[model samples]
Target chain A: MNQGWTERQRPPRLERRLEFADYETTRDFLDRAALVSERLGIYPDMSFGRTYVNITLHAQDDATEVGEPSRHFAREIDILLETEKTLDE
Target chain B: MNQGWTERQRPPRLERRLEFADYETTRDFLDRAALVSERLGIYPDMSFGRTYVNITLHAQDDATEVGEPSRHFAREIDILLETEKTLDE
Candidate 1:
């Protein structure tokens, strides 16, 4: 539903891919994202390489649908990324 | 190619799913795996929930096939897991 996220059908998940200039930046982003996830009490499924990170939030559950918490978590991540960008500048 | 890992066809990747007793153990395993990946100079695609971590090592590339580095990397991860298991005991 967001600009960078794709909704997948097979597993019913919202996915996003992020690319960074280097591995350090990518790792830093992941560390921050982990902290955010811990605070939010929700963890997105995550995959990463040297300069790329992919995150997925499942959309379907018995109690929740369409990844409501996941979307909120993504927004929080976006804020963290923005704050990191501002600091880098 | 080894126990606990499955070879997938769609994207041609080797995948392993690990389950932990708790989120803390899962995160600890992930942190150690990240370190091993960094030392090996190869990163696996990783996805995590509260108590499960799924990791995939791509098997196909122009220069590599069937995930040679990935299998080696997985072995390193297995070693790390063994070490952690020993520590836990």
Candidate 2:
């Protein structure tokens, strides 16, 4: 439950949908997010359209709670999106 | 109507699921597919996890038929996959 992220219960995961003005921005966000995953060793499931990407960070292992790692990954994604926006400004 | 593509009538979409051995290969295919969309002017919705991408090309202009353009785009995706495989060899 961090800002725009919604935490789901049954199958625990943090989900967020990010919107962009164009595909170029969307692609940039995606490419950078992938790098972040590699850096932090946390890969999320992502689905995208021309100007939007939905990211889901599922809880690690067989745990029943949305824990620290998912939160950290979500924070990283938030930072990534802000970094892209800052670059545009 | 392609080898791996299945046409869905209700939503009028041609859907295909592509499996990759690794994340790098998945990223390669996604990148190449984006380029193809730009080159061919046909965009399809893609959803992916760690090792698989599900692509759905919806019928254009509200038509009930999965038309030629959708088929052409699917063909391009198949070629893109093959092109990556060739590079890997």
Candidate 3:
């Protein structure tokens, strides 16, 4: 859904990086991402610092192709990023 | 001081890998780390998945040594992990 995502192959996954102005905003996004993971049962690997988060949604199997679940989860994360951005304004 | 920590060279830093039995425990550790960071004004870079977190405390400057502040922060984090472990029992 969000064109900002980058598709990566080899093992297959989608990744996106988002930057925030400060620690508070980054915390908010991480907390929201956790909630979404709970609701959808999709837990992406996330690496974050004070001002940024790198999220990776790996393919569900070893078929060398990404699937619906990861794409769906990425879309939800994209939505959360948008919501976080709006709050920053 | 907990001997479980690993010290790195080059840029110089202290690092430790913590494992949790579940996501809830992992979240608790992350939350407590944030609180400690705010109180002590030290923020370590962390990368975490569902069950583990890698914490790295960089040297305060370019002197190529992990100083007192980073050591103090690591001890506090060690304490937090101990407390979390007690709660788990």
Q: Sort by lDDT, best first.
A: 2, 3, 1
**For residues A1-89, could you state the per-residue lDDT of candidate 2 as single tens digits?**
44889889878888998888988788888889888877777768899988889998887779887778768878988887777778889
TM-score ranking, high to low: 3, 2, 1
Model 2 per-residue lDDT at B67: 80
lDDT of 2 by residue, B13-57 (tens): 889999999888888788899898888777688998778999998
Output the number of the DockQ-best candidate. 2
Stretches of model 2 off by over 4 angstroms after superposition: none
For candidate 2 chain B, the 10 contiguous residues with the lowest summed lDDT are B1-10
lDDT of each prediction vs. the true structure?
Answer: 0.80, 0.84, 0.84
TM-score of chain A of 3: 0.91
> 1 or 2, which is superior by DockQ?
2
lDDT of 3 at A76: 86
Can you tell me which runs of candidate 1 are displaced by over 4 Å? Answer: A6-13, B8-12
DockQ ranking from best candidate downward: 2, 3, 1
Cα deviation at B43, candidate 1, in Å, is 1.5
Candidate 3 residue pairs in clash (backbone atoms < 3 Å): none
DockQ of each: 0.61, 0.80, 0.74
lDDT of 1 by residue, B49-74 (tens): 77898887886565334556778898
What's the residue-level lDDT of B4 in candidate 2?
Answer: 91
